[model samples]
Target chain A: MRIGLLKRHSAVFIVYVILAILILTTGLLSDVFLTFRNLENLLRQVAPLGFVSVGQTFAILTAGIDLSIGSVVSMTSVLTTGMIEGQQQLVLPVLVLVFGLAILIGFINGTIISKTGVHPLIVTLGMMSVVQGGILLYTKAPTGSVPISYDFVAWGNVWKIPFPILLFASVATIAIIFLRLTVFGRYVYATGGNEEVARLSGIKTGRVKTIVYMICSFTAALTGIMLASRMGMGDPLVGERYMLDSIIPVLIGGTRLTGGVGGVAGTIGGIFIFIILSNALNLLDVTAYWQWIVEGLVVIVSVSLYFRQKR
Target chain B: MQVAVSKRLQRSPQHIRSLFERFGIYIFLAILIVTASLVSPNFLKPQNLKDILNQSAALGMVAIGQTFVILIGGGGLDLSVASVMSTVAVIMAHNTEGQNSLFIPVMGVCLLFGIIVGFINGTLITKRKVQPFMATLGMMIIVQGIRFLYTKGMPKGEFPPIQRYLATGDIGSVPTSIISLAVMVIIALFVLRKTTFGRKVYAIGGNVNTARLCGYNIDFTIISVYMISGFMASIAGLYLAGWIGISDNWVGKGYELDSIAAVVMGGTTFEGGRGGVLGTIVGVLIVMMLYNIVLLLGMPVQMQFVVKGVVIILATSFYASFRRTQT
Candidate 1:
């Protein structure tokens, strides 16, 4: 009976095992992989994605997707970096701008999708192109840099823990609380699990969808700001890779693409597993081209395993 | 008197709707043509017209493929089509490097690859019960990786003589690429309108549950449609390779979006069911024409994306409004 229970819960167990394997492999393969500096750097690298995926979790919980998140990240990164442009005093205002734009973009996505009754994919796909174009037109070419002080958010430590990891943890905590304790959180699950029934039960389906989309865009924007600080420059193409990376981790974490389930905790583990694997691969001196192949294979296997377990 | 007035009001709205539905594509095409002509004197010239048609041929072929997948409902998207195209192009170029007689073998391999990829997509979605978006997105990433791995991150080899001839050589006054595009569109039209498989596809899209109850082989039909799409995508890639005289990794970057936009603009609803090849052809022409007009106007390449983005939004909104009024 205990063995059967263990088998049933093996998906979650797999994440821990993978993480342990990654650590052991990396420790054996490269001197740099186990270093505190490298660990800190990895945390900083994964932080922005962690933030974006948290918001993605909310949207996915409602059985929708936000392709526009990557674009939002790019736009915010550009706008914030361009605004701050070595002006130390302008950092706070730039941060505010990022937040405002995130909310506005999120609101628009939510409103248009929920009100028109269009599929989230098409709407978000269109918005992705629109925002990408907006960034391209706005930047003309990638040319802006933030001062070193802004990097404090990305690189600083709070009593030995990296600030970026701290940010990720805080965001994850808030998301968990929201999902567990709030009316909106329950509504998200209900809506995702069965939209028609939720509607029949007096849930404002449109409002719920809108809020979810808004949250996604908002999180993406925040991540964008942090990434800009980390990179110290705005590249129009910077966040393009995040769109797929963010989703892959969520899927790896056992979030059904069909939505209505999964949480931030599993997503965190998924992110850590991915980051460790990637870092280990890099440490082993794998070529970039081969890395892509390996990464893709990992996703395919992980997702197939996830489905197999579900069945 | 009251009945007469009410009937007239209803008839007028219906008239307007029909006009919008039937002539809207033509209107967009005319506007693009006029705008292109106004922007550049070279736009209306035969040479430029030939160039535009040749350029659009590949995109048009892919869009036709996309129309089939979208018509099957289930929010079916095939991002792997572009990657599949690249893979086929690479295989064709590599195997038929110099042998003129090896064209048949190359084409056969490309077709088999398409079938395999499409089968995987279909099986995963239908048998494993994966969402179409997730399945195809995974396939897209996988196919791209395979292509990159096979080529070692750089496209290798060269197109054989016959393949190059098919891409660039003309038949009388018509470009071979254009001819190929026309042939594909015709074949697709025939499949959509006259075949049992095609009818089943529409029925499934219209309502899967009803179609299943009616004893349609849902799995086979869905798989076949995706296979058709994958085959068309490879054909497009082959033509693309021939036309460009070189195959490259980035040959079909973001093409899935372009194909989807063309399909959507062609009046196929993303929700699926009612759409036709006739509209899709016009949609392809309109999109191609827009690109040409943007180029002619000397607008930056970025502007092309902006225009496409706006067109997609407008097209969907128009469709949504039209549906509301119709119901």
Candidate 2:
């Protein structure tokens, strides 16, 4: 029975194993790698990606991708900071406005994709273009500032553990429960597993797909807000990396691009794997160029290995 | 054959509907041209029209290849084309130094690199069971990284004499780039129209399992399709570098999504097997005109992207709904 359980979760085990090897190597190479201060910095730095990946997990779970996630983050960061402009009193209203825009973008993307039966990639890609253009029109350069008191989400610590980590944990925990315990979550799996079958089985696959995309943009917006607080300002391109990088963790987490498989448990590990690798690379004085190469190779190699192990 | 003819005759309603699929892009093009001319008097001038055609040559080449990849669709999109284009541009700009003698070897290396990238992409998807998006997206990142590392973050230089001649020089008062693109378009049209490989591409896209049962080599055809896409992207990069007269890593930056957008707007369904390169040329023209008109209007360059996105959504949704009605 134990062996059967192990066989089922072999992908998760492989991911964690890779993470262990990466951590060991990184710690051995950098004397400060395991230090509390550096680890905290790493967690804080990766908070944005952490939130983005959870949203992406939902989208990919439905066999759809959200290329607009990065741009949504970009627009939110820029808009939030642009509106906040160093005023503590304005933060609440601006954030509400920013998330509302995010929701609308998600709604349009989901509607076009589900109702029209168009590919999610194309819809999100179009949305990416629109948001990118809108951001550019709004500001060509980094603009606006946030009030100093608004840093608790990204910088402040509770019980010596950073607030970002706590926030990420809560968000990720919510995703895990939503996916594991809810009928809606099973509907996502069923939809992704086979949309035709899911439809015939009485699941509103279109609505499921739409809501998943909305969930994705919502988390991406959360990441954008945290990032704006962390940076105290917004750059139009600040969220650019989240687009592809968000998918990497999910892929490394053993989530198939084909969807209906994998979970958030593995994704959290995947996010750490990425953060630690980049952190180690920074400490080792390697040029940042190699990190992309390494990431690309890791994605291809890790996914292939998981596939083989499944067989 | 008589029964098939009768069935097709009975489906004349869809045939009339498919006219929209066939000529809808042209109608859209006419509207844009009219709007453009009304917005800017110079838009209808010969020089502006030629300029639009000239600009489209590079995207036209890449989009033709994108058409092939999208034609045989099982999530078979090549996200790596942009990086491939940029890598070629960087290489030519970094190495040429205006020396035409180095053209042969450099072109060979660029084309070879393109093939290697395509081979890696195809093998991963076909043999390793990796999804197409995952495999190609990884290649895109890797290629971009390799280019940047080789250039050490910045590449510098201009194209050789031949590329310059092609970029700005005219043959018989028509731009050489246009002629070059025209030649390729004719060849692509003929191949897609009359060749065995072309039929197989559509066949595979129509139904992979049925194609497999019919003894078609699914893996080989898919791989070849990617190779074609890579080759065309590299070719586009060369022309783009010359036309722009310099190289920046961002030169080929937006081509991947842009080419996909163009191909889709040309009435090619993502489900595949429905569009051809001939339609893609018209698609390329419409896209280029939008860019030119936006520039002519002195609008913020970003709105070009916004318009492109709007057009893509509208075209895809229209086609998608129409396709559903047909069935």
Best by TM-score: 2
User: How do the predictions measure up, each by TM-score?
Assistant: 0.89, 0.96
Candidate 2 C-alpha error for residue A304, in Å: 1.3
Show the colliding residue pairs in model 1: none
Off by over 4 Å in 2: B1-13
Displacement of the residue B116 alpha carbon in candidate 1, Å: 2.0
- Going through the candidates in the order shown, the clash numbers are 0, 0
Can you tell me which runs of candidate 1 are displaced by over 4 Å? A1-37, B1-47, B98-101, B325-327
Q: Name the lDDT value of residue B313 in candidate 2.
A: 82
Q: Provide per-model DockQ scores.
A: 0.44, 0.73
Poorest 10 consecutive residues of model 1 chain B by lDDT?
Answer: B15-24
In candidate 2 the C-alpha lDDT for residue A245 amounts to 91
- Model 2: per-residue Cα lDDT over A199-270, one tens digit each: 999999989988998898999999998988888888899888898899999989988777899889889989
Cα misplacement distance, residue A97 of candidate 2 (Å): 1.0
The candidate scoring highest on lDDT is 2
